[model samples]
Target: MYGSQPARTGRTTLLAVLLAPALALAGALVLLAAPAHAANAPRTSVNPVIFVHGQEGSAQQWQSQAKRFSSNGYRDDQLYVHEYDTSVATDDHAIAGLEALVDTVRARTGAAQVDILAHSRGTRVAHAYLAVPERAAEVAKYVNLDGRTAAAPPGGVPTLAIWSSLQPNGSIGGAVNVHEPQAGHTESATSAESFGHIYAFLRGRAPLTTRVLPELPTSVEIAGRALYFPQNTGLAGRLEVWRLDPATGARAGLLPQHVVRVGADGAFGPLAVNGRGHYELALVRSGERTNHFYFEPFERSDRFVRLLVSPPGGVADSIDACPGHTALTVVRAREWRADTEGDDRLRIGGSDVLNAAVSPRLRQILGLFVFDKGCDAVSHLDAALPPFDRIPFLTATDLHLPADAQARGTIPVTQTMRGTGGIEETIAVPNWPSDRHTVSLLFKDYADIPSGG
Candidate 1:
């Protein structure tokens, strides 16, 4: 991992060192090397890509794929994301928003046509858009990502339909199809394999690199939105970017690196920072709970970083928020399957939270909200709470952990990958009190899957 400054050995680093031999044996540390001609290759006209996220998803769903596209020679300006309110019943409003977005991207990039990539419920909107001959005429190609099934490519646009484990037999009429057995619904859109197909179909050539390459200077520009979950509505707040200790997830400095005023649009950043650094994105609002977000690392410049937040007594108010304990939201794009072998295991504070009752394969849960369900100061790892389980792509569990009032104690979280020889990653975060602060963590979905894995 690259860091702006020398990073000291922390608990997570020590654990990784202990597993080095296993990682080496599994070849999990190997990365795809950039081709010699990739950077200097002849350029071609690239159409701007507009990504349509699924139900209950945000622009952040396309973050990794956008970086991958940039690494493969797509200009940052050529990537666009259309955000909509997924809770709405009909696609009429979303279609209008997308049509306007398409026009805007076309005008900005001066491209004759644009490529459209739609995942999950977004596919429904894309299908509606393409129903109009004029709209279809404006699209050069389309990617149907783990969403609906169709008899033919909508509007006869050249299409690539990627099916996840949930839809092994799904396909689009007259379109090339691929099935990824290891990927879940969201992973089908974010994984590198899916990117390869998308790039090849639109560019008419294989990508020179599939990896998210690190920036040349090791410093990257980051920008994003702080929006209400599902609604995609903006919130006015203060955004603080704080560098964290790589080992313990404690603040590296007493003060934050940058503080930006978030407007009603929920947009912030374009701030430059170390590409490989671990940092906490804290959203502060007057008389409201502060939401803190953490990611693995940024290998390149990212513009789609989303900080999904809600105010007190909002959509997320169902969770027990207490001063005596910390609330946690852990997420991974890949589905957690506990019924089969080669399944993922997530450990919070050294206890595995993934199990048959909590993370069954059929659930396809991507996010987990952890808290003291009844505020009885008891932890139950056996089953998911009904309220969270009813929510799309999300689940919750009761876990009691006394907060460190001073925020000095670290809550160690570890995830052992399904494949890649049990590759283990641990991120320790500060134990912030739940009443005033909430913590969220993001994990990568894919690793090298062996044959028949």
Candidate 2:
């Protein structure tokens, strides 16, 4: 039921052709550096990698690293993401789902073993899966990212534990521990530095390029799933893909580029798109508000684009909806740190939202929800709102951005560099009334950090 989708089988052969020159150069270097034993040993292939996400996390968290791997030489078919419901009390269901995914990956790739990478709460689940000798035998390597610590590597597998600045002293007894002082909790998993460490640990050599190299616009294609938040259940709806004007984030045309009826699996697309183009993915359901997701750009073919939504009249429905204001949620894989020196900056409608109360380092906020708190039509930029601030990995702000659904206006959202620099990115999106439309924006965690060249 899981592996039958076209996305699971679609291979990015075009990427290989484009990267041949770089790959060939890197291949020669490996041969020259090989030891006598390695030259005599059987030729080995890169193992299929399966990524497991943490609590309230989806496969989207691994989006950037997956692209980096592909750029370095991994095929589209060789990467998999195990998405599970993180709200459950125990790891029983997560372990089962991961085991099934691992088996499926092995069956399709025809490999004896696969590599596992888990972050945050997912480390516990991965460790539990590795506890069984049979399961451990199926894994070639393991990466524990800013998650659990142990006296020894789980199941005695070769492990790499990556700790962020937040956990300065975190480590595992029998694993290679690398500390990234510039990153926060989630950033340690998505940062280019983290990718370098992971690639070296898994491949026994540094990556040819840690960056997510871009493909030509004509060669870029995308596909993904629309799932219920926290449950990982697919949503059946009408999905519309519309190209947007990068400057103002306005629709390019009246008609969508592609219209699909998303099935129970919530899978859609293998649709071609411009690598430099911005897009809006609108998920529309009958008698329900449309959830509109905006992305910066698809620099390459992406298969893990997740559109997470809650059921109508569900958890999200509890949000205060009003016609007088626009509601927006900005997401980045990196944790926002507003309480620290030289902290990150987030500006919406020309006002900075990051503050000591709104984005404390300990909160490790990945999603920042902005709206008029209590429909009071007042802007309180100094502090975070209740309920949302209490939630893990999330925070909310009360900001008044007037909107008219009939005639939309652009609302500029700017993110300045964490340290000293001018603006890093500015994504201007339309101000849609919160009563009928929901806006979500995706931002890269390492927007200013370049990978190893």
Residues 1-453, candidate 1: write the lDDT tens digits: 001111111100000113367677875543332222223433357787899999988877788888778766566566788898887889998899899888877776568899999999999999999999999999999999998899999999999999999898999989999899878888899888888888989889887656666664344678878888778888889999998897899999779999999988888767877877888999999987788898776656777788887544555788887888988999887777777777888889887888888888888888888898777889998998977777767888889977978788899888887766988877779999998888999876655344220
lDDT of 2 by residue, 99-141 (tens): 8888888887679999999999999999999999999999999
Which regions in candidate 1 have their CA more than 4 angstroms from the true location?
A: 1-44, 311-315, 447-453
Off by over 4 Å in 2: 1-9, 13-44, 312-315, 448-451
RMSD for all candidates, in order, please: 7.3, 5.5
**Top-scoring candidate (TM-score):** 2
The Cα local distance difference test for each model comes to: 0.79, 0.82
User: Which whole-number lDDT from 0 to 100 does residue 355 have in model 1?
Assistant: 87
Which ten contiguous residues of candidate 2 have the minimum total lDDT? 30-39
Distance from true position, residue 198, model 1, in Å? 1.3
